[model samples]
Target: MGVVTSIIHKKINEEENTILFFGRILEYKGIDYLIKAEPLISEKIPNIKIIIAGSGDFSKYESMINHKNHFEIINEYIPDEKVSELFQKSSVVVLPYIEASQTGIIPIAYAFKKPVVATDVGSLSEVIVDGVTGFIVPPRDSKLLADSLLNILLNKNLKNSMGSAAYEFMKENMSWKGIAQKTIGEYQKLLGNFEKPRYLIGSLQ
Candidate 1:
């Protein structure tokens, strides 16, 4: 996922676009919310383009986005290799999940140093610090989501600043190497504190 975001970031940078979103096409993902907010966002930035990748049942939300032609919907299960291709083709990666326990997708956005606009649900807030790495809004609020998205898209300085901060955060904390070392240290401590059982030699004799 990180690799994909990096690719998308590179490409979008070349095109000078502002934002993007990548992930599965699940109902819980809040595509409906994004679709609903499209017109509101477009009222501000008419050129704003939202690229949605990954396949799922979007028939219900299709009508919602029909009038707003600024969105590009890739309605197919993007393969692992193709993920980077998609990511490289866009700007910011949005994750508006209604429920989550720590998302693997967040790390990918961090990897590309792409600023995020995720809902303040579950562990998402823990991952994305509002106004720092990215903005976090109340879940199911399309207006707030649209506002955040517009803010990032319109403000290049803020977008770059947040992206840099996000990248630094990932480098300092979320890397696989750092996680492995921390996990190993915890295991070692647990093993060192483990007690050994004593045998009842007198009873056996």
Candidate 2:
């Protein structure tokens, strides 16, 4: 997937017009955090839009977000094909998850060469280098998230540099070809020696 995204991004050349958040709409995905951060971000960059791509019971969450200006909610499960469209349209991708393992979403963002702003929890920091690929704010810190988002939006050069670095990193390390080759090597090392089982499942005398 990462390999595919990298190739697609290289073919397109256009400026971004929005920011996108992709994932489940559960409480832990930190939609609430983003909602709170939006107002602060909008104050500085009014034209910047935050596009929420995923569905959940957003009634409570909606109230928290400042819907007065720059926000759009696509409260539905985004299909795989349309994900690229979302990525292409957005300036940056944010993964403000409270808890996570290795996220597939991060790779997708990298593949698209879109800079990310993620909370420093789980394996997110491992993937995103602060000030290189994107900024990693402490989890649950809406102020930091807002600040980081604002910084990336306001500075076009920083955004482009980070996006370029992310794309290069993904191409070299995170591709399916790279993963499969490494996995095969590991399996071969483990299965190098041949042995016959001495015991039988059933014996008859």
Best by lDDT: 2
For candidate 2, the clash count comes to: 0
lDDT of 1 by residue, 29-59 (tens): 8888888778888889877788888777767
Instruction: Give the distance in Å from residue 10's predicted Cα in candidate 2 to where it truly belongs.
Output: 12
On residues 90-119, what C-alpha lDDT tens digit does candidate 2 reach at each position?
Answer: 889998888877687878888888899999
TM-score of 1: 0.81
lDDT of 1: 0.76
Question: For model 1, which pairs clash?
Answer: 4-84, 7-88, 8-87, 8-88, 8-89, 19-92, 20-92
Per-residue error for 200 in candidate 1, Å, reads 19
For each candidate, give its TM-score against the true structure.
0.81, 0.81
Off by over 4 Å in 1: 1-14, 184-205
